[model samples]
Target: MDREAKKEAFRKYLESSGVLDALTKVLVSLYEESDKPSAAVEFIKQKLGGPSLSEHEKLQAEKMDLQRKYDELLAAHRDACKELEELRNLKHEGDVKEMVDNNDAKEM
Candidate 1:
């Protein structure tokens, strides 16, 4: 109901969910590192089993590549459908021409 009460409830939730313990362990590991990482936040995130910056970047690149490929494939599919429709129309026209020619020949 109050600000302090909300903070206490959230803190209890974190402790009960083991988030506080996990963070403590990760922090301890970072503190004990012989050579501290220049990117301390990234180091802590990685220690906490989150993706490091480079890995995140690599995944982003991969997703972009896949999206590009999907767009290309979609364009190709649309083109193929258009071509197929044109071919069907041509065949229909040819069939109609043949029928008309046959009727003219019968009249002659």
Candidate 2:
């Protein structure tokens, strides 16, 4: 079928949609007058990619930022684990008892 026939069929389909009556009228009018207003939303989204970051690009950036944050956190956690292991090895056997005794003396 031709573009006009397709536009007429779309108009018929859109008649059942009360929510989009104004949009349907506008698009149908445009479609009848010209070949425009027939492009689907996905087509427009695909066409508008990345002059200043489309929605998909923005989401990918956000995901990368989150992954970087997670990697930083993991690095910090590993450093903390290494430091904790070093502190454990450096601690004298009686150090905990000395601290407990000092705190008890302070309380008294």
Candidate 3:
């Protein structure tokens, strides 16, 4: 039933007074074992219960963070490629020195 009735029934049952709580207790204890008994499955089921939008929100937040990181890394990689192309086209010592300086700045 509800909380108060269930509690009173449990206490009375522990007091060895009646037989109504027998089926309920047995059913609760054996709930997961009727057809598909699994401790892991029950644990996961319990974890997913109870107003649980947080798990979905957490996954979305993680996806956003990963997307942001991916965009940053992609931009850095493209810039690195462009700099590498410029360095390849360098024609003199001064040009090589400038490219090396720019590369060092990028590393910093």
Candidate 4:
């Protein structure tokens, strides 16, 4: 494509994808800053790195918390199952012992 066509295409892409609006808002925020940053890059970074970054961090923390809870619950379930199996084994042994005792009593 030619230079004019490429420029038009880039502008259209920026406008259609909301990049233009985001840049405009960032620039406006930088202009309104009481304590202006020394560097333009820093100003842009500060304005652009707004709520989205914090929201992502908050979501990560919540995910970690949920994962920890899930792990604890899984461990507890496994422990309970192990205990149940032990109880079952003990009950089976007691039944066998009772049968043997009854047979000996009958013989006597």
Candidate 1 lands at a TM-score of: 0.80
- The per-prediction CA RMSD against the true structure, in angstroms, equals 2.0, 9.3, 14.7, 4.7
- The most accurate candidate by lDDT is 1
Candidate 1 local Cα displacement, residue 72, angstroms: 2.0
TM-score per candidate:
0.80, 0.42, 0.39, 0.54
Best by TM-score: 1
Candidate 4 lDDT over 1-108, as tens digits, reads 999999999999999999999999999988898987778775686667654555768999999999999999999999999999999999999999999999999999
Model 1 lDDT on a 0 to 1 scale: 0.97
Error of 4 at 84 (Å): 0.5
Clashing pairs in 3: none
Give the per-residue Cα lDDT of candidate 4 at 41.
73
Question: How high is the lDDT of residue 74 in model 3?
Answer: 100
Ranked candidates (TM-score, high to low): 1, 4, 2, 3
| Each model's backbone clash number | 0, 0, 0, 0
What lDDT would candidate 3 get against the real structure?
0.70
lDDT of 1 by residue, 1-108 (tens): 999999999999999999999999999999999999999999998988899889999999999999999999999999999999999999999999999999999999
Task: Decide which is better by TM-score, 2 or 3.
Answer: 2
lDDT (0 to 1) per candidate: 0.97, 0.71, 0.70, 0.89
lDDT of 2 at 39: 49
